[model samples]
Target chain A: MSGGLTLVVALPLLAALILILLSRLERRKGAIAGPGFFQRNGVAVGLYLAVAVGFWAFFIIVLPQLAMVDLSFRPKLPPSQMGGPKDIFTLENYRYFLFGSTTSTANWNWLHIKAFFLSIGVSILITLLNLAICYPLAFHMAQSAPVARLRVLLLLLIIPYWVNEILRAFAFRVLLSSGGVVNKLLMGGGLLDAPIDFLGNDVGLYMGLSYAYLLMMIFPLYNAIESLDRNQIEAARDLGAPWWHIHAFVVMPHAKPGIASGCTLVFMLSAGALAAPLVLGGPRTLWFTPIVYDRFYQAFNWPQGAAYALILLFACIVFVLAVLRMFRLSLGEIAR
Target chain B: MAAAVELEGVNVTFGDFVAVRDANLTIEPGEFFSFLGPSGCGKTTLLRTISAFIEPTRGTVRIGGRDMKGIGPNKRPTALIFQNLALFPMMTVAENIGYGLRVRGVPRHERDEKVKNLLIQIALPEHGHKLVSELSGGQRQRVAIARALAVEPSVLLLDEPLSALDLKLRQHMRAELRAIQKRVGITFIYITHDQGEALTMSDRIAVMNAGVIEQVGNGRSVYAEPRTPFVASFVGENNAIRGRITQAANGTATLDTPIGPLTGRNPVGLPAGDEALIFVRPEALKLGGDPPSGFEGEALDVTYEGSITHVTMRVRTGQKITLSLGGGAAGILPQPGDMLKVGFEPQDGLLLARPERS
Candidate 1:
């Protein structure tokens, strides 16, 4: 291995060793007025172990491509018949991904900007649709209906989500297909001269993707609207303010926190989504996810996929961090 | 020419259940009227019907002699302070108080000036810019009144606005609320399940039960002379002596009860040969040596509550009666199971024509 690779593995180990030594030294110093010296040392050691655990968790779970290939396959070249020794520090595949070498010209180095921008648009659209659809329904339903009826409506919305995501996408595929009932009805009504192109196109991809992620957006918004105090609305009316004023002043402001949290959750989920795009998206509707898939499955490019995957993960982390900073929140505050 | 607020045969129904039955009531201008009852007794529904949140199913609400049909809450010159006070926690005190004016397209300077006056009127002068959450319970209560008053409504409706406060704060607010009502000189229709708040604050009290108005009168009249069993039992602590009427004449009645023949003041609509329960307040029943002049009973139990001692005892034929004795009385404080003489004059017990079954 190259010296840089060797040091990449050694630095964290050195830090762990130092932490263990410091913990032992602190234990020998005895207790203090605050926490027990052993307890404080244990806490410091625990923080170090957490960092170690977190690094490996990313190494093993998040970046599974390089982790899998490193443990099983030959690193540098094609194996001899049964199995053979392979060189460790070869830069051949990385060159293939980045430069598109003649040996493997199909490799696409992951750019990630296209997918990142697409996800942002998709998250915004989903948030708007959820707010529009749920605001009126939840507000009217909260006061007028009995609690039992409200529960039933909520349960019905949740039940459709219990079906496997693949099944749901397949169902949408059937709806968007040319010979399907949706297109047939429209064609029969003279709305279209012929069945429209849907599945295997961007239209079908948008339809399927929205259907998959809408539930995540709707649930948080509905909960927020339901928790709003009903009497405040009545007070606004009694105060002689019109309907719009009442909503703008009292109802909307009270539910603002809920809207913030719901938007954050829906935005993250829509951005990271893989299954809907992989299945429903046509060749024309290229997103960042399928790029990661092709690099891993078809090109036999493990290192490049790892780099690409880490890029996507880092983008998501940054996006969440930015939202938290703007709203003065932490992941701890946003937990369900 | 007419009363300030009038409900002519108002009835409110919720699906299959009738929350308020045909109820007739009228309040003159500048009157502090209260709808008082236990919870789910339809006092709140009546308030909402008047406020136009819930339209009356079978009656017309007339405010200042105008039929309130096709009039929504926003069109009406009325304001209701909700049971929770419903103060906007997101807004500051001055902003909340100025909301009505702000909604009315009043200019910024004028609205601010009006809010300043209202803050001073509520005695929360320095708290004009504080958030609603930062204010104390008593301060919030006054802020609610100020907000309602800022609208300059013909009638102000308050629905248990003091219920959220502590006991001491609630008492202080009771006085403050009445003072505000008087100072504003606007008709106030208050809804509360608390009889104490109603009796203490209202110029006239409307006692309601099971969607029906049991009685409506001045506080002292309602307290001293309750018209029905529900009103007597609800208004104050009373000893209901169950009996069968033997005879009735000249606003006085003779009844044969478990305590032998009992003579008591008569209630209207009670004819002879009817079963009625007599309501005598605990304070009105006297317990001492020889029962003053013409009555007798034995002291069964004595419960001292600081200033007044509550003595429970049995009359001649094993009927228990509770009487309140002042603490400073120059006599021995009675205890449980002590036989003593007790007397309540015929005027004290208000005979009910139809005594409550329970």
Candidate 2:
């Protein structure tokens, strides 16, 4: 592709590797925080600073050198003669979304607009759904049950994750197809008059997508909930807080990290989710990932695809960082 | 007036294992009662039964002259401060203190007023707004107390609450807990495995072992006139001397043994033919020149323990007996293998029935 695109991917990888290597080093090295990082085998601390600096440095190199083409004119075709003669530094591509203006289109207008809006909607939807389903489940799984009961349930939760993620997604695909068990049951039980669209629809997309990523939302929430001291609940109970009051005042506040992490996980996964939504959502749901995919693979528009992909990658990083910030989790803090 | 609690024939069995069996005791209202024993001695099991955490497998638990059948922990008029001091960490000091009142639907203003009073009662009037996490270990302990007391239960149950503190802090908290109990004037059922703690704080102490109450009386009575060998040995340190009875009469028993005729006070219910153990409190045993009328012995070893010198001596029967002598005692210090005489009054020596399989 372009030098800017190459640097965007390579810089973080190189930095992470170097940071990891520095972790194995003695206190004398000057790779990162010098004494602070090198003295300790604090791999996570090293990685965090390395990743943050790497992202910042990569952005410095790419943002100025990258080409931004304005396609708000009549022609919806990409010109072969682009990013060569004109200035590399342009804010026109960003301005279209942030500040809509009067302009002429001369590029692939429909693809960019569709990809941008779809990514936003999908990310928001997934985050909300994950919050809805996982919050109480994690809370219940953590606090509500007696110790003996939750022990077995936790084993059940820990089991499926061991079976692998892709297998779980593919299993959802089988369940949501037109002639799958769900549709058959619906028709057989007279819940539906006829077999309607199950696979390759929004319903299928949500079902498959949520199922595949629920564990990601669940484990962190469970850990947060599990770590909450029961003394807090008993204290609430002693304080004359009814059951609900205890949950609202005592349990929820401590679980802020779990909630943030769960939301962030679903947002990151669903935004660029290629497999489940692709398999279940079919052709109509052109996610931003696949849009980038088409340019890179089908149209051979590597530079343009890299640009869009960089935007998606950058957004994920910002969203994750924002959540981490809210929870007061530094790179070191969020480490397992 | 009805007793605050009457546990009659209370037996708690976990499957084949008996935690507490045939426990019978009556705790008068406002009495500072303690169940003291070594670990796994079922003292805590009895305490838990009284608190309604574990239902007695048999017998009756009575409170206010009412049988406490099917009365769960929350339903019972008792506030149990768990061993771990399960204070809610998410709440502030005042919030924790007012928890009991709040749960009882007491209004916020009333809860606040009561919590304020409790904070003062706990000697921390200014800590109400502070988070529990901010409090020191001792402060957290006080907060746990204030919260339990805020419930205003007629009976307060403490399950080894002072076990977590360091030795010096534990000693301080022990005094503080006793003072608080006295101020509140409620029936405090304290459970501990510490003998010294029980003797110091308890109005009446019940010494339990192997799911049964070995002996129950005031601390002095349990310590002085231990009815069984278990009570005598377990309640406090005592030198046990084994001898067979030769002459038995009213309040006097002469045990015929190798050490010559050893005189001991007759504890009631000891038959003449029954094999008995003579228990002598350490300080009571006198070691010097002439032994009492019919006693003679040779000093084996003497160990100085700052306050007292522990003397070990062998009598004519070849059995060695130990005694605690005060450091300031005006006498030649007995050395190892030195020939001397040791004697004790009959009141100081008690004959105990053999231990019953525990």
Winning model by TM-score: 1
- Each candidate's B-chain TM-score, in sequence, is 0.94, 0.92
After superposition, candidate 2 runs with Cα above 4 Å error: A1-83, A95-155, A158-167, A190-192, A196-201, A225-246, A249-259, A282-336, B59-62, B65-72, B257-260, B289-307, B312-321, B356-358
Candidate 1 docking classification: medium
Clashing pairs in 1: B297-B340, B297-B342, B298-B340, B299-B340, B300-B313, B300-B337
Q: B159-239 in candidate 1: lDDT tens per residue?
A: 988888889988988998888888899999999988899999999999999999999999998898888888998998888
Model 1 chain A: weakest 10-residue lDDT segment is: A73-82
| Model 2: lDDT to the true structure | 0.77
**lDDT (Cα atoms) of all candidates against the true structure:** 0.77, 0.77
Scanning candidate 2 chain A in windows of ten residues, the lowest lDDT window is A68-77
lDDT of 1 by residue, A223-335 (tens): 66677778888888888899989878887677565656766666666666778787777766667777777767876765566555656666677776876777666666555
**Model 2 Cα shift for residue A2 (angstroms):** 18
Which candidate number has the best DockQ?
Answer: 1
Judged by lDDT, which candidate is best? Answer: 1
Predictions' DockQ, in order: 0.66, 0.29
